[model samples]
Target: MGQTIIEKILSSHSGQEARAGDIVVAELDYVMGQDGTAPLAIRAFADLGGKDVFDRERVAFVIDHSAPSPNEGVSALHKLMREFSREKGFKLYDIGEGVCHQLLPESGEVGPGSLVIGADSHTCTYGALNAFSTGVGSTDLAGGLISGKMWFKVPGTIKFVCNGVLPPGVYSKDLILYLIGRVTADGATYMAVEFTGEAIGALSQEARFTISNMAIEMGAKAGLMEADDKTFAWLRRFTSRKFTPVTADPDAVYTRVLECDAAKLEPQVARPHRVDNVVPVSGAAGKPVQQAVIGTCTNGRLEDLRIAAGILGGRKIHRDVRLIVAPSSRRVFLDAMAEGIIQTLVEAGAVMVTPGCGPCVGTHNGVPSDGETVISTANRNFKGRMGNSNAEIYLASPATVAASAVTGKITDPREFI
Candidate 1:
């Protein structure tokens, strides 16, 4: 019996043959905590009487969730994190650096075959680099900080093989939304998802990151793509880290195998209150929107920004719509600025915000009022996710968001492209 990618990674880290359901304590390559969770983790570490972290260089604290201090409470938390980081010698990414998931990889802390964990649920975003990453609670992160290790019950694998070229205006976001709709939220609970096939190979690094970042929405334990030339090339641009790419064996066991043709996929949208409540763009078109947000860890990469800029160039957002554009990282923001994407978006009536989580976490920036409808590129669309239970959030690709912003309605991106 050959091992899947997750199995192989775990086996290597645990020094034993790993399989689904096997509980083992594996050494972690990296551990991270965001502002929303780091305080709890720090308290837990103190309660455990921790004098020093096992590996200060391997731990990080990212201040993004309530960046710029939404209030005094959050500002105090940021101060606490900064003080702790200085004391422990752990890396700290301050506000405006970007979301943890986006900045972590950009900093070269993540790579193939690494075991990474974060206090944020979207930690699975690193799986796009073929790393075995997942989210843990504050206490778990505290434990990892102390021991540089964490326990895991290996998960079964679900293989998604996507082939064929994607049609114009359809993107990785659409493919993920379609899959989540098919599986329904919680359908793949705690299962490892491995994406493969020609279409995945053809996707840019940004698209791959977008796909892996949203696996949690479908209840996946970890969403991964086999590392290839593209993955290595992207990593090279960030760091000189030496990594041996890991791939599932040809005969690796899988709980299920799904085949998809990307050419047939359409732009997908997740309606209010539920990520699985997805529909084709055409089916949801003509619905009015009051706001549109074009950025997040899920789809706020440079490629996503360019896509939105292309759609909005030479056109202004509808008078009734308020559009917000937030790049995922400072590096992305600079690159976009150099390319004039930021200028184009701003000229088209989009408000450019800091390179952080922005409206995605609803902690600050771009929260909608009651009865408003918002189209966003963020991952989740649960009720009240954007700070107000009465305001509805619709999740879509950046292109779709830009198009809808231009029309003040739910418009198909294909119409604009």
Candidate 2:
């Protein structure tokens, strides 16, 4: 009879009691779109005969995917977004600012118990802050912009109870990949996943973001987590907003429950063509690689960079392999520079690029050649995900990618650690 986290958040926003499968119109605290989706959303707003947005301060646009205008066509779209933001007096993040998911939390547009919707599937990333966030189509995003509210059918919750301590060489990425492999890509379709227990609670806020960012990969609507002192501390560092943390009732209903032991997990990799086609590092070890990428919206935080630098400090990558490093945001880039993490990576034969969603989206940089293999820290690994169906992608933790970069093959991070 108790409400889960998603139900409670939706109820608060809708001004009524909400239950799974109930349709309600909930007020939105924030809405966002990036270059990849903003053009369509802007056009949709005009098509809807929308005038000024409901709130200029609550709507934002970020130009990150295919940043710096990969081609004249993308440049024109960026120009349109810029003009629209200027005309509407809405906030706009220009090139190299960061991915929308990373920038939103950094700018404090998201907080616990807030309702957020974005034009990007990874908008679910904000759920790490304990918000009820999900992705909407361009038309839905336009409606939310014009009216400051959107409708939702409350989703049933799937509880993932992870216990025990993570091993030294393992991390949140490995744990998430392992979970995805178990559940398969469509296992949690249209449902909300609530990650809990000691292992998840022990992770850093950034790590939690990585987990939430990938929820959509498993066909989840949103990923929710409980807030504690660590969550508040992380929020305080960005904004002074007061947030009321939400927790599920002890007897909240769940569609299914999965219990995992973190101590039993090892580094995991999702082979090409499908994210769910995952295997342990040893299962795919020694496979040759032509490129290795160490950043994305999922694992491009400062902690991720430090993990890579720790392995490549006094070493150089394989001569046959190309290592690409991209910081997630300008702040992360500058902080890494101040701490010499950037220098360590570059001196170790890594090529540093601007902070944005470059290689991950296959928009502009680091596109592999035909018949080549790449190991990356990005979330997805479908065919042609990196701009070429002929080039294969292997998804792994940053440590695994860095270690593989050094050896020109798929190598286990535990060996390097």
- List the candidates' TM-scores in order: 0.99, 0.99
Reference-based lDDT, residue 324, model 1: 93
lDDT of each: 0.93, 0.93
Model 1: which ten-residue window has the lowest total lDDT? Answer: 48-57
TM-score of 1: 0.99
Task: Tell me the spans in candidate 2 whose CA falls farther than 4 Å from its real position.
Answer: none
TM-score of predicted model 2?
A: 0.99
- Residue range 110-222, candidate 2, lDDT tens digits: 89998999999988988889998999899999999999999999999999999997899899999999999999999889999999989989999988998999999999999
- What's the lDDT for residue 339 in model 2? 95
**Predicted candidate 1 versus true structure: per-residue lDDT over 1-417, tens digit per residue:** 999999999999999999999998999999999999999999999997878999988999999888889889898999999999999998999999998889989988799999999999999998999999999999999999999999999999999999897898999999999989998899889899998998889899889999999899989989999999999999999999899889899999999999999989999999988999999998889999999999888988999999999999999999999999889999999999999999999999999888888898788898899999999999998888989989999999999999999999999999987
